[model samples]
Target: MAVAIVRNVRPWGGAAADVVIDGTRIREVRPASPAAAGTDGESVDGRGLLALPGFVNAHAHVDKSWWGRPWVPYGGEPTTQGRIAHERAERGPLGLPSVDGATAVLREFLRHGTTATRTHVDVDLGVGLRGIEVVREAVDRLDGAVDVEIVAFPQDGVMRRPGVLDLLDAAAAAGAASIGGLDPAGIDRDPVAQLDGLFAIAERRGVGLDIHLHDRGELGAFQFELIIDRTLRAGLQGRVTISHGFALGELPEPRRLELLDRFAEAGISWATVAPPATAPLPWREMAARGIGIGLGTDGIRDLWSPFGDGDMLGIALGFARLHGARTDGDLTAAVALASAQASPFVHRDLHDLAAGAPADLVLLDAENVPDALVRGPRRALVIAGGRVVARDGDVLL
Candidate 1:
């Protein structure tokens, strides 16, 4: 097997070491031997670079985002239903989000060192599978540069969209990896039926589940508990993820503790974009409870808001600052949540850095992991599956 070495890089801000890559796996990591640095193997001079595992975007709307499109102002109604209508209205005259647009967004993510993602593509009555098709094309185009998990998301209410359930199943058969749901209680208005339909589709399709929960306070808490119950009953413990679980912040201390325990018991995972408008989740507490917590950019510079720069580094910084995490330990934990914590919920091989880990690594121009999280430095190099896919903000492969 051909061998490649990244010499003199500080792995997670530790002492300098050499990472030996054999094909798609990291074969070895050892203290740097300057004398043998250039002896054999294909070498990458990693002096002054901090090597960390590539970021994993646990939740993102790959199809709904207007990343490469001409900047359009947020023209949707403030209400969720109105916004869904507005999104539907635009898809026709504007046409489905193009393959080029989706590819551009993926490239932007690569520039910021995100090597893997779980992208939510809309699968509803309005657009059917057009968005999923184009986004899947983009994902296929960037196959090795970034590994993406396709979530057949129902941006519109699943139960309200009649026949959307079959569409979701078709999306899975066509290539989607997971089934997605939106607001079983708030939007669907039939929590039990919505949960049943979602779980049933997931069961029938033989895929995982990712539900978007924007419902808040008591109702949100109820929906969350119900979903967890279904997950356990379906025996899909670690296979289920709740995105934008804002309800977790609304519960009282005692109730929150109970739910946290339940979440851990059911092996539930939560994905958050750390939006400023909502109550920030007690991330540290949930993490301690052994609940899987992952971070995302939600929607990029899309129609929802004029935020999101496709920078996972910046997102991590925002996460740390949002929670007032100033200590090195706290900041380090935030970084891990944004990157490695996603492994259990997504794919472990793609998000971890170990001897047998996939060669999905980011070399950033930072002295240490904490500094990278705080400063959000530019990526020096990005390697995906042992291939140099990007460098200095440019996509190479």
Candidate 2:
């Protein structure tokens, strides 16, 4: 049976139409009918607002954020290793990875019109698999208002910490969508051993690998090559992703182009948080070569840093500003990278406001995609899985 009808909405700033929903999928989109508008509870009047697919957060850290809790001052060092030490020492006392913390952050994501996400949950020896469990319970608490794909992340060193591989394997076997790795060469100090171990586990468990490569310059480029070679060897093409690969934009032109070609051949994808200080990515070149790029809000108010707000629109704007997006087409593309173009990151074949796609969408009172990306006004309505989940910046579920 049809759940609801969103009447008189302009999809992607196009012609006004009526979007019909049935259960968890979009039934159809047809020309608006004057007689179809009703005050009944089964229909929602869109008021000709701009409708877009609900945002997809390609990369996120949802487990450790202390949102909705009393303010915890940022006392960690600036470097990567320093932050890791600080989190390990501080998280235990704060009761980090609790269901309440994860639920609060997820609610924020939903209130910002994000309907789905690919979140990295911590899986170290201290917490073991407890963090993953907390995140699962948090998602359930929302009654499926937000869809989350889990990545069992070894935030600490993987090779240096023995028995972590077994934990990752257990996570994969227990139905985690993918496994994550941190700076292998920089943190573990043994690039080959770390990469080989992660690849081995991914291959054996039939899961994907999403590694965090924070090593910059030639060191980072070298690790990229290793990942490409290993991906091809393990037949894991299209199943591997590199998060925060800051070196691709810093390499020399010739070397960078060469690596981009190889990356395309190996089906490697890139996820970035679009920090202001980093070099602009060669997004045009990567797009020409058919490489996928997805944007994310890394971590919000977490032990790592006191930044981010779980808003995908803000991340899209940062990406546009970083890449110097000016024209209308480029701005629209930037918005796409945050919504429709991010399907593969969350293992979705299709996530849009069209027929046969999941009925996940956001309605904003803006002129078009460019206006929405620039202003990022409160979402007038948010529908997930053919159900109304949020209204006017408030989460209903």
In terms of TM-score, which candidate is strongest?
2
What TM-score would every model get versus the actual structure? 0.95, 0.98
Give the per-residue lDDT digits (tens) of candidate 2, residues 263-369: 99999999999989998899999989989899999988989988888899999999999999999899999999999999999988988888988999899999999
lDDT for 8 (candidate 1): 83
Q: What is the lDDT of candidate 2?
A: 0.92
Model 2 spans with C-alpha error above 4 angstroms: none
Model 1: per-residue Cα lDDT over 1-397, one tens digit each: 1338778888888888888889888988898876554424378778658898888888887676676667778887988778888877876665556787688888888888888888998888777888888887897898747888889998888888799989988988887889999998889899899899989988877898999998889989999899889989988888888998888887898999899888888888899888766787888788888888888877776656667777877777877877888998888888888777677655674456679887878998886788888788889888887878888888875
Q: Give all candidates' CA lDDT scores.
A: 0.82, 0.92
The worst-scoring run of ten residues by lDDT in candidate 1 lies at 33-42
* True lDDT of residue 104, candidate 1: 80
279, model 1: CA deviation in Å?
A: 1.3
RMSD in Å for all candidates: 2.0, 1.2
Name the best candidate (by lDDT): 2
Error of 1 at 345 (Å): 3.4
TM-score of predicted model 2? 0.98
